[model samples]
Target: MSGAVSWIYLDVGLDTCTQGHDCQHICINNGSSYICKCQGGYVLNADQKTCSRSDACTQGHECQHVCLKNGDSYYCMCHEGYVLNADQNTCSRSNTCAQGHDCQHICVKNGDSHLCTCHDGYVLNGDQKMCSRKNLNLTLTFEMHVVVLIHVLMVMIASICVNSDKSYICMCRVGYVLNPDKKTCSRKKPRSSDTCAQGHDCQHICVSTDDSFVCKCRMGYVLNADQKTCSRKNSDLYKRHDVFATVF
Candidate 1:
């Protein structure tokens, strides 16, 4: 017989197909070789055997705020009260009122965003943002009305001024002119004293001239339209006034 001629054949390719083989993600067998692949949000690493996050924000890939990956795509996001800028990666402030800022009179920038504020004689409402008249329920007695009328009459007779808060002051006291403070009276210069010494209430700079003093602002500030106050030149100084009314 030919028993001594019998031989055996081995399938080497099947021996190499061991589930995922040595791949970090998925491995496909091709009889004689294999290949590695990754799932969504990941890509084959440099070694071609492992996977890495595809949305990594490093080097050329960057995000102004945050970057996220989902199924081969990525997106940029910004903090509250901000919206994606024209660049798509950066952010900018959104409309104050649209973002829930309840400003009754004006909305001014606080930092990257804005805040609600009210004009003089107004107070923040229960919402803590909207503004409302503080003394809405105010009532005057007969005697108080009489007194107010008398003060008004005096103001008219003396050529003085009276504010809504019942504040009264002489616009031009005898021999004196209205000072930069508006509440105080200043004497014309060329006299024995210097009116600039009265603290013109000029927030930034004050310069004395021949007869009176001029109110000036610092380098980065501008003289308010009133020509007596100072405000930041880069800020919206002309916006609605947002200070409490006080008696002069």
Candidate 2:
């Protein structure tokens, strides 16, 4: 009988707050009794009726990254290589390559910057982010001889060579420059950029010149019309001196 009375006293304390009472906050029915409660960041006044702002963060928050606390105030922060989410509590991986980049082919991270590259059948465009199909025109392998002649004729119109003291000095017209052979001419190359100056796009070998660059193919292969690509050299065709016909 005494134990039952003790249990009743423990379950219901004072038991004064009710629906009709002026709590100025929430009313909680704690078993048979009631208590006045305030929302988050609020504290109940000494009168047990009024509530005031506590200017504080609730204890034991679930911040995904790190929880920052300053006296009674608190916030959340993310670690490196992560970003804070919209809820200001959770975090996400730093999506610089997928969400923040404009690369149309491949995006690779290099130190603090990102590098964009294209696939095998594609070449990087002027923007360096987008890719374009390589200009390997549809033609039979035997027909490259004719294509070579066309490329030579295009070079002929650009510059001319003059004989001086048994040697030759190429006199290039505007926007043209002497080729690696120093006898023919090719179009003036693009301005060497800091990005491109660091490397070349050749598949086999990259050769640097005075004012430009050149791509070379290894043995058993020949440089293609695109000057960067390569194709197998026809040894039988090279043996036939009549294979090449000079273009006028």
Candidate 3:
């Protein structure tokens, strides 16, 4: 008899918020338990006990780079080498190098754009950002000559040679992209099936690239410290005017 009584008390228990909860704003009734919910303009955090600001990046916030909240309002911030537009919302690229633009050697401005150049005796890498010592070895020279010949040949074949590293890379022209072979510039279709290797298991989205793949977060979520994981944005940034529950 006690075993049956104990099962009802422990297994199918019911202390579900009948005596109030630690939820900052409100508590919701579940099937056999309860959950905490934040008020409007707020959201519950991963802790499941505290509440933080929500709608931080909504309608009013049109920040170009990042959005920040202060008190009951929100503001915008610009990245380095950028200036806030007159509207105080958007950002525009600035010519000043400052802490922006990853350049290993020197930076030069041409019109509104900038270029990265290496010092003498150094050559720009494939990324056009870092620099390395120029390799003028005979073998490398022969490769360059071979690259030129291949480029000319590609032009005759309705293709283009954009890379000279090791051998070449077929730079597909507009309305065209490289086929699975990475050599044939096939006409671009409306959409292509995701061919990412099985077991990619990205949280939200996975984008395939020439070299590898990129993982991206979904809307209303931000990439966490671990690039593969995601978390609700503004969930921990609320302070002023936001009454949060303390886990005492």
Each prediction's TM-score against the native? 0.35, 0.28, 0.30
lDDT of each: 0.65, 0.70, 0.70
Deviation in Å, model 1, residue 22 alpha carbon: 7.3
Candidate 1 lDDT, tens digit per residue, 36-139? 88887677988988998775554234558877654456678888778888787888877665666656688876766677778866777777578776552254
Where model 2 places Cα greater than 4 Å from the true spot, the runs are 1-42, 45-49, 52-56, 65-92, 109-113, 133-248
Number of backbone collisions per candidate: 0, 0, 0
Ranking by TM-score: 1, 3, 2
Superposed by TM-score, candidate 2 places the C-alpha of residue 161 at a distance from the truth, in angstroms, of 24
Tens digits of lDDT, candidate 3, 190-210: 543554564465688877765
Which one wins by TM-score: 1 or 2?
1
Summarize candidate 2's per-residue lDDT along 116-226 as a digit string, tens digits.
Answer: 998876778898899986544432233344434645777557655444432335566788877786555677877654433668787787877765688999998989988
| Candidate closer to the true structure by lDDT (higher is better), 1 or 3 | 3
* Collision pairs in model 1: none
Evaluated at residue 202, the lDDT of candidate 1 is: 73
Query: Residue 178 error for model 2, in Å?
Result: 31
The 10-residue segment of model 3 with minimum total lDDT is 239-248
